[model samples]
Target: MEIQEKKNIYVGVQTTQTRDIRDFFMEIDSYKNILVFAEVGEDKVCDNSLELLGEANRLKNIRNNDSFVIAALVGHNVKKYAPTLFGYGADKVVAFDSPMLEVYRSDLYGEALAGIVRTYHPEIVLVGATALGSELAPTVAAKLRTGLAAHCTALKILDNGQFTQVVPAFGGKVLGDIYIPNHRPQIASIKAGITKKLDYAPKDGVVEDFSCELNGFERMKVTKVEKETETCKSLNEADCIVVGGFGIGSKEEWSKLEELASLLGGANGCTRPVLDAGWVSNEKAMIGTSGVAVRPKAYLGIGVSGAAHHTCGIKDSGLIISINKDENAPIFACSDYKVVADYKKIVPALIEELKARKG
Candidate 1:
């Protein structure tokens, strides 16, 4: 028995160059519309999903002329969030209400999104870089045999009709721009907090209900979903951060740093090396590029070397103060205030001063 080749349809991310190539072969004439997947939670859409909708709305204005933004939302109570999406700029919302989508299962959610893409034939697809989004986007792209760019920090529609996607690379030391040079519906996942969500006046956009019947094979069976305990505090969301580096010496010595953080009503963090040394968990590590990017009211760097990777992460902080023995440390360049002394002596003394003040 021999298999036969089916009709070759480009089922993936589309770019300007790809469009031109497709145009030469008359494939561009079959172009459809853009589609954005809204990651629906139980009661609210994730913030990144709203951000994607805002970006989609912006892209639609540039390309559509008369076309509208199509938002595909999957989950129970998806309809309830359609109005908010409209207020945020979705011209049309395709609600796929289902019990299976209530909790994010990769198999079920991916299949649902893939089915919608096949039905609508969107020219582009955008997703957020959330845990669920990361799982669903790649699967959907693979099922549809399309290209995908992940963790995109920037997105723009070029004049020539191509979507340029930018992401951080080289351990966040540099930025890389990617494009699907030849594909159908261009797919990209944007990282959270990269784009601002817009607040637009509510428009009388249409909301359509979409229903699909899945057979035993087509329907995914989810046996169990285990939730992990969120033990680490998100440094990015913290108001104040106390950072310790090699100068702190040992894990036992970190107590002084913690005392200072407690005095200031802040959380204690460490550099990458300190965390790797079993001094602290990665969650409490506040190293530069590879770790969480923080913008706090006050960031105190204790005995930190201030590598480009670490410095970049805390550059957005409101006030940066560094205490290191090396007067020429790189951290001093970016620190708003610097103390040239041994952090072992300085941190303990500072904690005492804070405690005395409170007394």
Candidate 2:
């Protein structure tokens, strides 16, 4: 197929949020190209980053190769992986190597990215929803003063030469479609796992290393980097999840919920109130909207009210069994099966039944 070159449409890329915010605006596009921000030395480029490239490649094909994909990296050893990123579909890799970029500080990375975007006006900009990504994407959007969408689950190009950003709203109960109709560049941040990565193919592309001048605002001082200690497997990746809500009644009764989860080879999760009440760690809590979205093999909702926020996260689970005293609870509507009884009485009995079944 003959690849058509798009005279418009450019994508701006930036490192994870730890970099300078202004770096997002440094580019001026003479033609249509997708810019991918390469996070060097981070070892793991976020899954969403590769997903964006894949989508861009797909768009390129749909546009008959009228567009090209360009990757931008800022680090000391960026040249090493230029070939790898190109193989993944980038037509060009722009490198900005420096010691300052080694450690990501939002101020520095943001500045560098912003400068690039301003110099090259891309039609669209994509970033991962990581800690650094969340921080930097919004800042760049704000700086560029353009429309920005967060936590998008899907992205596509409309036939009319516009980008469509789809995300879950009201706690995943509904999908919201967003677009920047009048903006020069529509910006969106995509959640990981929502999209798939494309296979790497052989491609010949140019790798250009350019020296950058870091100014005062571009240099953000770091006082400390405190690492979090209480690490647990993310709920989104769990095989099974047992969630409790206000109906669990008391902190003392949590053990019953934990026991049931253990039997099923699952981990314990909770609603917002339970986590706020200190019954479980925040990481173990499974509330709606604010927590991780999960699609486990089995989800046991104990005493949950089935509010829009709480139920939205678990709707994707393969099996859902809800335990509530009130048959009319909103949660019942979404459950595969429902048990109308007091959790205090039924939980212990259910645990025993599970154990007996195992035996």
Candidate 3:
């Protein structure tokens, strides 16, 4: 069997006694539901899981009854999280409960997820592009022999049940629209905070048990689990954000941004270069096409060069205020209020003014 790739599209050649692309396309309509991985963290469903659920609900609304939204949850004592999942817009939840499945093991979780996909064929599968999801989504996709659009910034469902995945490429310089027409369960691991969390309204939904057999933790040994000490603020839920870019300069100036964020009672975010420069602790604090997408009430970009990739994340923001040294910076075009000045001088003055006004 030969697979031809032309401009990011994969075309499968016919093989003896194998399903061709046409066969898969013909079978596409039969596949129902937009499935999402309801990943549990510390016995609760994470925000990213809910974000995917909300997005899936939108697509299901567009597709109508032809496609329902379902969540595949795997964990020990995780059935309790199903109500939240349903309230967030899942039609049904498949709970895989077992002691061995408590912690995330790639082999066991992948096998169980693959089994669920085989048993109940869904047209689309969504996972949060978190640490676990990054590891698991690819594994499931490989096991099922399907295409996965990783870290997609946006999604659109066509009339024919096809998905157009939007993501950044070439160091966040360009947006790429990816389509996987000849695949079942169009899998994508969307970055956290790209989609809004669904409004909580409890509804009538079924939680069915999904059983998976697992060996006694023999495949992989977990000697110790060390959680990262630093936790970045959730940009998705922030009403205001203070973002820094490459122009922010030095670690000291980055700390000043943090103080500004604190003064505004919001979070501190950064562009890709800031994150790459180790100015921020985690990728969650980075906002761009390749990073987290935020829709804040007020966004203050300090010393930032507004690249297309960075603007894509904050385009949905309500009021944008940009401070830059260059008057001709592209960021000024998007800013509601633009100040041409050295951010190092202006930021300290602004902080003092804000303090004085509050005092």
Candidate 4:
């Protein structure tokens, strides 16, 4: 951390065409700095950016030298977030602020991000695998003629300085580790909430302005954008989660999961199958390798068959209670408390027990 502080002192001295940029590229095949794509929405920085910043901070500490964690922030009025990014361990923030960037247009954001990459030439670039990032990362990568690993579940800087990208393969049956040895800036769009956010620490970091014009990119203009407001508690933040799977016989049974969750002072979650079956009304409720990964204090799996993808999401739960009719359900192998019974019978009993205790 002290090393990064010293490096940030002179970061503002790099002119747009200074020999530093050219010299760094000419002398070193790969720069040591890590870059994170900080996406903004509703004039606020998204949590995914902070997650990546946190991971980048850890990676920087592990590298433990002059390595810096820089953030590429693009949006209107997002310069106010520079201090927050610095608190999250960003050594410097390259902000591209324009009225044209108020809303997310893939082409505009991509072009701006690509320009940053061409100028700074970081060793690794991390982006969130959200809707915007899924589209934005590839576009920037294509423009820069680089490869990107999408939906990465894990990232590690190997002993040989190669960035190892880990993602689910063959429909979550196995995990594949990917590395881009030839690319200058190894890019990866990772899933959100996989890593914990770092504690805030004030730092002396510079927020440099990057200019972009949309004169020729008029075709990529965003006419209108409607934002969705969320009222439900986020599954990732829930301390306790009650999840149902395809074994949840019907929609009515799925509703019982909500009631059970309320009784437990928690929230309801579901596997991908349950979401696909229309049992869960919201996709945010789904927990799997493809969806949100949760590590709650206590997780109750009702009628869950425990697919590999689903179990992988909850593997970090403090206490996993799997209640499935099948005694040999795979979830039982990883569960701390296993009950061999139908959820239809167990759900009511749990609610009643909790009610009696309250009485």
> Could you say which candidate leads in lDDT?
3
Cα lDDT, all candidates: 0.73, 0.70, 0.82, 0.79
For each candidate in turn, the TM-score is 0.73, 0.73, 0.87, 0.87
Q: What is the lDDT of candidate 4?
A: 0.79
Q: Look at candidate 4 and tell me the lDDT of residue 17.
A: 62
lDDT of 4 by residue, 1-359 (tens): 00111110111123446333433444336566899999877667788889899999888877777889989988788899999899887999999989888778887888888888888888889998777898999898777656688877777778886667776666565666776655557788876777668998887788999886655765564668787877678887789999988898889777788888988888889988788888777877888666777889999998888766677678778889889999988788888899998788878998999989978
- Expressed as tens digits, the lDDT of each residue in 232-300 for candidate 1 is 555656688999998788989987887788788887778888877888865435545445456789999
Query: Candidate 3 — which residues are off by over 4 angstroms?
Result: 1-29, 216-219, 229-237
lDDT value, residue 90 of candidate 1: 82
Q: What is the per-residue lDDT of model 3 for residues 1-359, given as tens digits with 9 covering 90 to 100? A: 01112134332223436765555454666778899999988658988899899999898888887678889998788888989999998999998888878778898888888888878899889999888999999999887877788888788877775677876667555566677666676788887767877899999888989875566424686678886665766787789999999998887778888878888889989998888888876877888756777889999999898887788778889999999999998888889999999998988987898788878
Superposed by TM-score, candidate 3 places the C-alpha of residue 155 at a distance from the truth, in angstroms, of 0.9
- Comparing 1 with 3 on lDDT, the higher-scoring candidate is 3
- Candidate 1 Cα lDDT to native: 0.73
- Clashes in predicted model 3: 0
lDDT, candidate 3, at 201? 94
Those runs of model 4 whose alpha carbons end farther than 4 Å from true positions after fitting are 1-28
True lDDT of residue 273, candidate 1: 83
Clashing pairs in 4: none
Cα TM-score of candidate 3: 0.87
Q: Can you tell me which runs of candidate 2 are displaced by over 4 Å?
A: 1-31, 36-42, 58-65, 74-92, 168-175, 199-206, 218-220, 245-251, 270-278, 283-290, 304-317, 324-342, 357-359
| CA RMSD of each candidate after superposition | 8.7, 8.2, 5.1, 8.4
